[model samples]
Target: MFSLKAALAVPFAKFIVKKEQKWINNPLETQERVFQDLINDAASTAFGVDHEFASIKSHADYVKRVPIRDYEDLKPYVDRVVAGESDVLWKGKPLYFAKTSGTTSGAKYIPLTKESMPTHVAAARNAILSYIHETGNAKFVSGKMIFLQGSPVLTEQNGIQLGRLSGIVAHFVPKYLQKNRMPSWETNCIDDWETKVEAVVKETLPEDMTVISGIPSWVQMYFEKIQEKTGKKVGDVFKNFNLFIFGGVNYEPYRAKFESLIGRKVDSIELYPASEGFFAYQDKQNEKGMLLLLNGGIFYEFVPADEFFNENPIRLTLKDVKVGVNYVMIISTNAGLWAYNVGDTIMFTSIKPFRVIVSGRIKHFISAFGEHVIGKEVEQALKEGIEGSNFQISEFTVSPQINPESGLPFHEWFIEFENNVENVSDLATKIDAALQEQNSYYFDLIKGKVLQPLKISEVKKNGFQTYMKSVGKLGGQNKIPRLSNDRVIADKIYDLNLIK
Candidate 1:
């Protein structure tokens, strides 16, 4: 029965792929249409009236009316929506609020309107369908699929349901996939991440698990637990488990560790999803970047990352964006996020069909001594430095060590290694060289003796996990920032004595 159903989905998947090619081929047109639709739909809402959306005709006109806003800047309007005010941001009350923890603000409620909610589900399904179309492998669809996400339990706020984005998405799993989904509802409701993983392990032990999906860090924990329970690799236990779907964090740094955990290389799909909107997904098996979703009810604006903080930075449309430049992604979505900065920095790998890789967050960087180093640069440096070596990194983070007790100040890297490196000092030197090669500012800083070379602090086994647990953010969409301007996380790691 499962095989027959899987066979039936192939044709449907191919059809969807063919249909998506239209928008992919006409990116600018599709974005313009989405932008116009958003404006027209919410013309009667309070935000539209305040911004004079009814009079807005073009991207230029819209931009002139709506200034770019972060969460804090837009909170006033969002508060009205949360206070049971209809048509405050969108046309009506949001179907759900994706509750996310903010750095400065407590909890952020990102509204998911009726018109916007389906895009999240559709994009995820399309990512899978695109994979099937490209690889012609649908047999995995017949087996059990597990999404390691938050509990489906949601609380009500005003007239809207509120939960973590993953939890809210849990309630929208397609009926066809309901039976194939693993970790029964009761098991999924467990709040403790460790306990939930154990429950998931016991339930999925006897099943033919095929697709495993979650954030890479949390998924690594799951794989570790599975190995602990079975005394075998994940690939050995589940022969058919071939596809790994991951989002939230970059998977390149974790690739070597994951391959070791699974005991084999498996196909993986990288998704660019957030509480605001589903932005992109890996559409090709061998592609370097995910296909940016132009027709997915989002109007994108790009501001060059370097100029992002400047007074009135240039906001370029899709057609004006250039390849290889890191830009802060701004979006006006059907969900009523007007000129909103999603906070992600993306570098366009391709212009035709529009593909992008999330480079890093705009706010997450290390520039203490005027050597601005972004997340992508650091990840690339580590990957290049550790290339072909037996050293496997479990997790790592970088921070600026402004006031060193002994030597001139330098960048500090806290890394949890899965295996021991023969010489940590040599590895650190290689990584520093890689970073210097990529970033000229960093290179000049080192040459001018403004900053010393980067240093690595070995984190004991599961040290990052211990630090996260200490702060009450062990799992469930929580991830460690790759770079920090301050030593907040570094100090905490020291406090817990997780450093070697």
Candidate 2:
């Protein structure tokens, strides 16, 4: 069959693959050029003037003059931008404001400029293109791809479009690929997730779906709907399905269940896109780490994760980082965010070619007893616990129980199972053991009696969904947090537990 979409995508995809390959070949040169270009592009902007960008010729000067900041610190400038102010953060007003959760901090409006939009588009396109070039898999582009995305309905805030990043990206789908997209405009516009997913199942059931992409949990929900509707696995419904591209949440804990839902092994790709920028994506099939974007309209910085709470912490640029150190990712982007902390933590797995694996979130951790357990460790522990178990987990979260009057302080895990565990306590023990192996501080806390053993609270079916719905965060791009330092989110989940 002649594939017009494939034909149209191939040339540009190939060009991007080649370009990225060349760019990664000389890391230092690419970093230098990207930094210089970013500085030059924003030299005339208000932030540029205030920061004295004209005199900054070296990385040292740039680092010295500009301070590392989080979204709260950048709020004044973003406030000015939101008030229809031009040239406050970027050269001009942003085309859109990516509305996303600030987690415990509240909501945020991240600017998306003309210069920054291409970074997301190109990086996303090249991720697929790079995979195709490596595996000679043109079938994904040859057929329709069911991108489970948010509705591209915009609400104007100061004459600026404000919506989810996925929605914003959906509107910019290439004309050539639009024919190969799914759910229809009307179906996608449905605001409710349940209604939208059901409609998607009906719309996509009869179509050719070779590739499916979304957050892992939402994709799982879609697969469940397909199985419920057709009484067949996803692989049977879409036999041509060969690619599963996922992001937003760590895929490790859900990997087994995702594989079972599809009913067969498929090629998978992971991305690390935030509202601020498209930072990294899996570029190699055999590799364990994602290739960090160097030339994509963004200049990178890293602060040691452990030292981030300090009044002034050691900030390292791309040229100064070493592999294996956990760092809170910071970026200065063309989108008008300068030295902004995006909140996620990552550690470089390889430095020669610059590959990273997301470690955890800065705020999402259990350190009440100074155990300092993070999302990555918790995720790994969960994966280890479920290795040979018959049960599959749907969703889970952990929080510290620090009240001394309530017997002893312990970490509580609220888990919703896809299948019932025959020995829930045994699994919990294994998970606790696995966590101890990963973090010595956690083990010491347990040994010193500073914290009690990990306790499991098996939640009822759809417990997390119910919780999310109750909180009005049930839909697009909203993820169940893996770890909470306090009992704020976990206590609500505990209240929703019917199984306990």
Candidate 3:
């Protein structure tokens, strides 16, 4: 019925793909132009003037002039902007504040201005458009594509609009495609996640759902609800469901469960986006990494993951980065963030094309007793350990138990499963053995008895979901931290006493 939509988009999508391919071939040149443009645009802002933007001639000068900052360092300026200050960070007041989950450093309000909206909104749109162009799969756009996003109902803080990042992006969906979007505004605005999912299920079930997009976890929930309501797998209900677009969390561990829920495998694409920016996306199939958005409105820097916590670490630009080294990402963007650490770590897989895989977050590493382990290691271990296991993990988090009262320093895994395990001890041992093989530091700790072997606690059904609800992080784009450095969140999970 809507073949015209496919025909019209094909030419434009091809143009974008061709342009991106050429830009990616010359990443350094593209990045330099982006950085220069950002500096020129924000030269009059408070931060720009304070850092003497006029004197910044190169990436080195910019780095030296503006010290790397995290959200805490920029909070004062952001607060002033929230209080109606103009030109504090950008040329004018922000159009909205993207409220991120407080899971790590507490809830943060990232400013979003008109100049920045195109980068965030258009990049996401291009992910799909690029997929259609590269794979010649535009028919999906002819049918409904449900994006499981946060409620667009925003709050006004000191005359500035604020809401979840996903919600803000949803408001900017192109008018041409509004007819194919699902979940009415009222249905999307439901405060409770459980209620919202049910409403979304009802609204989208009777429609032609060709593409489903969101975090894998929430999409899994929506699939389960659909199966429960109709006694049929998601694919059976939506025969045209062909593409799955996901981000916000690694999909490796959840792939098995997602396939099981859908009752078959579906082509999927991954995106790397945060409240701060849209960073990368899968440009081709059967690829292990995402192509970085080099020509986007952002400048990139990398600090060696091993040296990121050091007092002074060497910084590398796009020209000097090496594939396979885990690096903490820093960026300067059109949105007024300069040399800012968004807390994510990534490793490049293809230097020529600048493709990267998200490794983990800096704060989300376990190093309580010098057994420093990152999210990538833990996830890899779990995937290997569960390869042939009878049960599947729905969600999990690991933390250090350092107190002697807890019986020696050790790593504790609180896991929620899709099905109960036959032998908990065996599962725990397999996971520990797998982790030890991947991380020598952890192996040494266990060998030297500085830390005991890892321990596991099986969670009751819906335990993690209930905990997320209690903390008001129940819906779209929020995810369980795979690893924590301290016992803060782990203690709460232990207190839940959902052990099976």
The Cα error of candidate 3 at residue 385, in Å, is 0.5
lDDT of 1 at 274: 94
Give every collision pair in model 1.
none
Looking at model 3, which ten-residue stretch has the lowest summed lDDT?
Answer: 491-500
Q: Write one digit per residue (lDDT tens) for candidate 2, span 440-495.
A: 99999888888878988888888888988988887688888899998888768757
Tell me how far the alpha carbon of residue 266 in candidate 3 is from the true structure, in angstroms, after superposition: 0.4
Off by more than 4 A, model 1: none
Task: Give the alpha carbon lDDT tens digit for every residue of 1-500 in model 3.
Answer: 54998888889899888877788888888998998998888888998899899888898898789888999898888878878889988888888999986544687889888877788877888888888887887888888988898899999998789998889888998998899888898998887889999999999989999999999888888998999999999999999898999998899889888888898999999999888889999887877899899877889999998998788788899889998888999998877888999999999999878899999999899998888899999999889888887677788899888884756778989888898577877878888999999889999999998999888878888788877877678878888889999887777766766666
Per-residue lDDT of candidate 1, residues 1-500 (tens digit): 34987898899999999999999998888888998899999999999999999999998898799999999999999999989999988988999999999878899999999998999999999999999999999999999999999988999978799999999999999999999998899998999999999999999989999999999999999999999999999999999999999999999999999999999999999999899999999999887899999888888999999999999899999889999999999999988899999899999999987999999999999888888799999999999999988889999999999999998899999999998767999899999999999999999999999899999999999999999999889989999999999999999999999998
**Candidate 3: Cα lDDT at 466:** 77
What are the lDDT figures for the candidates, one per model?
Answer: 0.94, 0.87, 0.87
Q: What would you estimate as the lDDT of candidate 2?
A: 0.87
lDDT score, candidate 2, position 102 = 74
TM-score of each: 0.99, 0.96, 0.96
RMSD after CA superposition, every candidate: 0.9, 1.7, 1.7
